[model samples]
Target: MDLAGMERSSLVKYLVRQLEHFFPDGQHDLSFRIEKDLDQALARLEVCIDAVKIWRKGEFDYLHSSQYTIFLYFLSNTIWRSRQDKRLCTKLFYLNKALNGIDCFYEIEMPDIFFIGHSVGIVLAKADYANYLVLYQNSTVGKNHGIAPKLEEGVIMYPNTAIIGDCHVKARSVIAQGVSVINKDTMPNSYVFQSNSGALEFKPCSKNILGDIFRHV
Candidate 1:
């Protein structure tokens, strides 16, 4: 993605136009603000790009760029958060729908950093997040019984993993595929999953599942 190219320029222009359409707050300097935060935005984008591995050998793959778009939309929302205008929030809220990321609105309190792979059925509610979080497809982290989960750093949620309720998922934990942790406090450095008997299980997780992505950060 060459920022100087016409394609990138046109895309940015279209996004700005969309923001203007939905939010007429008239922040003419919004583009400049995005550019000012480009380093951090690119850093966040790098996490998702590394997580997805769509580009190999320095070659970009257009077929899988929806992941790219997802992260970019997140970055845009994050930048707007710093600006914090009602109209901007509305723009980002609808932008989530426009990006096809179900229930992944921008008003949620996101981590200092995180990654959403393909962002399928990802519902980020009003919960606090730590850094180095990775969310796979169909994974959800939201409130249950009027309480939201608190996620620590280096927590990875595999596909269909749900951490609902007032659960405390400690650092360096991996919620395995199809597992749900509702109202349970997870142990740090553990792997939590579903057993063959349809019950949840937990064990020590000593692997670096997202090492490359975090190392780049």
Candidate 2:
């Protein structure tokens, strides 16, 4: 994959510089392990980028906020999985949050083929996320009473939507904008909307909503 105008080494340096700039306490200096694991993270990112219809298949632009947000999540998650270094992971997590306004921790296991429509105001908790999960701005997937939601494949959470607490979001289910699904279950291939009575209403949808955003949906 092409890293816009930067080489792999330059990208690594850039990430380290950002981390240092954000966390200048001298206790969060990144080790050489980041360089070693960067390739794996980029490889994972490539798979996701290639699946996206709008993004170029083989190019990655660091200046793009949404792309950078996903890349940071991948890098931080990769480092956490490979090295288990909390200090470096914390620094990367904080850097991502500061830059993207998203609260995705390094320890959370995100799917390999998910897409973030907008980086700001998105919070993801420790939920069971499947591939082809699409998240938009101000969307949240959080836990309530220690129970998180299970987002199946091809699930799309539109802008300002949320799925909280023991929700079994079935495949091909689209959560409509500004809707909050709390402790609820959605049928497969359905659209979740909020009625005037403040209750969730499921409507059968035959259209492939994820097909517009993802390839081979």
Per-model TM values vs. the true structure? 0.72, 0.96
Give me the candidate number with maximum lDDT. 2
| Candidate 1 structure quality by residue, lDDT tens digits, 82-133 | 6655554456567656665657655665665566666657777778788878
RMSD of each: 4.4, 1.3
Q: What are the lDDT scores of the predictions, listed in order?
A: 0.67, 0.90
C-alpha lDDT of residue 29 in model 1: 65
Best by TM-score: 2
lDDT of 2: 0.90
Q: Report the C-alpha lDDT of model 2 over 1-217, residue by residue, as the tens digit.
A: 9999999889888887887778787754364768868889999999999999999999999998888999989998998899787888888888889999999999999998988988789999999999999999999999999999998899999999999998999999999999999999999999999999879999999788888999998
Error of 1 at 189 (Å): 1.3
Q: Per-residue lDDT for 98 in model 2?
A: 94
